[model samples]
Target: MTAVAAGSYPTAPGYNVNVRSGPGTQYRVVRTLPRGARVTINCQKPGQAVTGPYGTTNIWDNIGVGEYVSDAYVRTGSDGYVTGRCG
Candidate 1:
């Protein structure tokens, strides 16, 4: 596990991290990710974003996709759409 670069795409080579719409605890479950899930992150925004009728919580944005993970979930790599180590 390493530090995921902010505003950068995830690259764990088989990581399936969660993706929410908002940035916090109140967010609901928007969707689950599988292995090699790559998502772009918006460092400017923090926490989880909730959306839809259920107000699912997960990494999200109008611009692109973001990931919700700790420093231990993934390792940093060159900026761009990197494959995730999903389980």
Candidate 2:
């Protein structure tokens, strides 16, 4: 699993933005992040979590999904979260 600290941009296209209670697949569906949403990776863990109200969250990272996005999916630097399309 990749170790991405909080404040890192997602490197995958059309990545499933599954909202969790904490930060894993185990948590309930807080919401799903739309494609190109600027996500600030927070933490990383091994395997999914299975014990809380959801299940097992793991093999992923956490982040604070931005509220609104502009036409700038590409992340050049860590200034803030951005989403759109990259050339």
Candidate 3:
């Protein structure tokens, strides 16, 4: 299947989501995205499963080098992976 283009997606409307060092919450919090922040997904990886405003998923979106946010919090339209899988 074709992957969604790398594009900016919004985080859950009113929550400041955590950006982790890896693809899971087990990783350190690298940063925190402010409420209403938008992030351009560079890639994705399967990691810790998370339940958020959208739904439960193990998908983590790479927003930057060493930065990942749960796909559960990003509105990518699809419930599945939107971008290419991170190598």
Candidate 4:
């Protein structure tokens, strides 16, 4: 996995996005990010596809160490590497 630069992602309005232990919904929910919360995307990886306010995608984003949220629920202004890949 390639390392991407750090970037910001805004959660959907009026919804708390799930931060899972893994990249997919099948994984346990680790925490929740409040609506409109701007988070720092640490990395990204392929995982179970999900539909969020933005759209449907299998792209999952790493928000914290061992924590992730679906890209679909996050609004990243631009698409590309946001930070270095997780080890």
Candidate 5:
């Protein structure tokens, strides 16, 4: 598994990504990040399995303290170890 860095800015490629309260769609929607939005990945972990224009992945990126958006809609340039793991 790769870590999405704490300050790395990953972009949303296709449409808007739903920023959720947690790492899955089961969580409430905190906001919607427009396409091309630079998301600051605070940490990353495997959560819900999500598929988007990019593909399917279990990697969920923490954008803020509790704000999470799936890696499915986020292009982090690499598939692994872009940042540290969440506690």
Candidate 6:
């Protein structure tokens, strides 16, 4: 996992977000994050655009190996990438 000094971002309140194996929803869901969960974004990559509590975006945050969550569901205080792009 990549280390990001930006800290962690919170998931949309009251919603349990899905963590996919890839950057997009087309990928298999590896797990579901509980509501009010906070995640540290290791890296980000372009993926399927999704509209969530935060807004619409195509950015996906990699929280763990093979685990990604839509940026639209994460409150990162920015509508842009908060960390380095995934290699």
3-55 per-residue lDDT for model 4 (tens digits): 65577767888898889999788999988887679888877898898987778
The local lDDT score (0 to 100) that residue 82 gets in candidate 3 is 84
TM-scores, one per candidate? 0.38, 0.42, 0.93, 0.82, 0.83, 0.93
User: Model 1: C-alpha RMSD to truth?
Assistant: 11.6
lDDT of 5 at 28: 97
Better of 4 and 5 by lDDT: 5
What would the per-residue lDDT of candidate 3 be over residues 2-68, giving only the tens digit for each residue?
A: 9657799999999999999999888999889999999999999999999999999999999999999
User: Lowest-scoring 10 consecutive residues by lDDT in candidate 2?
Assistant: 65-74
> Which residue window of length 10 is worst by lDDT in model 4?
77-86
Tens digit of lDDT per residue, candidate 6, span 4-84? 386688899999999999989899999999999999999999999999999999999999999999999999999999989
Q: Local error of candidate 2 at 56, Å?
A: 14
lDDT of 2 by residue, 1-87 (tens): 996444545433555445555533445666666665566544333434333222222233444342221112224243232222221
Ranking by lDDT: 3, 6, 5, 4, 1, 2
Model-by-model lDDT, in order?
0.41, 0.39, 0.94, 0.80, 0.80, 0.94
Estimate the lDDT of model 6.
0.94
Candidate 3 Cα deviation (angstroms), residue 10:
0.5
Model 6: how far residue 22 lies from native, Å = 0.5
Candidates 2 and 4 compared: the better one by TM-score is 4
Candidate 1, residues 1-87, lDDT tens digits: the string is 998664544434555555444455455546656776554444423334434322233422322343344322333332222344222
Please give the RMSD to the true structure for each candidate, in Å.
11.6, 12.9, 3.1, 3.9, 4.5, 3.0
Q: If both were scored by TM-score, which would come out higher, candidate 1 or candidate 6? A: 6
True-structure lDDT of candidate 5: 0.80
Segments in model 5 whose C-alpha atoms lie over 4 Å from true places: 1-7
Per-residue lDDT, model 5, residue 3, is 67
